[model samples]
Target chain A: EADIYQTPRYLVIGTGKKITLECSQTMGHDKMYWYQQDPGMELHLIHYSYGVNSTEKGDLSSESTVSRIRTEHFPLTLESARPSHTSQYLCASSPPGGANYGYTFGSGTRLTVV
Target chain B: AQTVTQSQPEMSVQEAETVTLSCTYDTSENNYYLFWYKQPPSRQMILVIRQEAYKQQNATENRFSVNFQKAAKSFSLKISDSQLGDTAMYFCAFMPLNNNDMRFGAGTRLTVKP
Candidate 1:
């Protein structure tokens, strides 16, 4: 079955360590997004990509950057991890936006930076 | 800018009972979409239901349904015959018809008791 996938379901890293969260969808959706889920269980959009080579930051500002080099892949990278960065990262994808479309989200990656 | 809000921070329902989670959004655009998502303890975000602003009828999926009041800018989710698996953090989201970004509300944690 076609689905979105996020690797490293859980990660623990030291402060200042560089890390990448991988997100890929086999559905061939044109739009993909990354959301940071806080301890309060609220989700905040951090980044999104309309298509390959087109990426933009979302409402929530973050030190991480994302790249969409392939239609199926959108990866988020933190140049240097910090304790404050510890949270669940969720990746989602939906067919080109504008119309009413529901997203297919992947099981998030729980990152804990010490 | 669009903003989504979930008034209830937490709620509980006995198994086989019904529960409603309220969600309100602020948006100037007439054409938009509303969504309800469920995040389980495992942290997998799942789409529960969706409602279109242009449609007068509410959307329903199995035991889940939505009460969409476009004039009031309110969209709420009603879970019928709640089960153990229904215990999770529920989030309300809003997306404009012309905008690619989606705004999510702080979730409401729902616990289904046996």
Candidate 2:
């Protein structure tokens, strides 16, 4: 199993509440990504970070924000959650050198906004 | 912008039989990487196989193999001797060589019936 871990495997909250999903990797990868997926559907890239202090929005627009203050930690937060944001959030990390290998993913956090 | 497509939203195969999943991608860059990731019921996204765009030979790992038709912009996966354990959501993804962002196709849910 990969060293990557995501806390709160499942979450349910009110629509207006602020929420944070935690993602950390012991692999010390330089690149980390967050993807949003509906049940049994394709995944959409929401956010990503190349390294500390370097973050970018993905092809899909998202109200959520992410911070990469540490090489192993990339946490995503929503200032105000909504029902439309309900989805499975996946975290993945990969090493440097563009090898295209070593992409380790976490189990993902399933969020539901009521 | 790079985009990946998996036309098959779902597939089924008898135990011990073989199955193939289709994936196509669009990109202007000549060098990139393709990957197939499996997400099981547990929700952990696992990397199954990967192929480099420049390589002429398709990538294979045990029972998983890829048909990389670069000119056709098609990358399909063939699973040999299917097993019930292989039942999961399979995703096709692409990553450009110089970019850190990876794009994923809508997944194909594979069901192996015994």
TM-score of each: 0.95, 0.95
Summarize candidate 1's per-residue lDDT along A2-89 as a digit string, tens digits: 2999999999999999999999999889999999988665688899888999999988889999999999999999999999999999
lDDT of 2 by residue, B12-80 (tens): 999999999999999999999999999888768899999999999999999999999999999999999
- Predicted candidate 1 versus true structure: per-residue lDDT over B85-113, tens digit per residue: 99999999988887767788989999999
DockQ of every model listed? 0.68, 0.64
Candidate 2 on A1-114: residue-level lDDT in tens? 758999889999998999999999997789999989886566788998889999999878999999999999999999999999999999988888754773789999999999
**What docking tier does model 1 reach?**
medium
> Whose DockQ is greatest here?
1
Each candidate's lDDT (Cα)? 0.90, 0.91
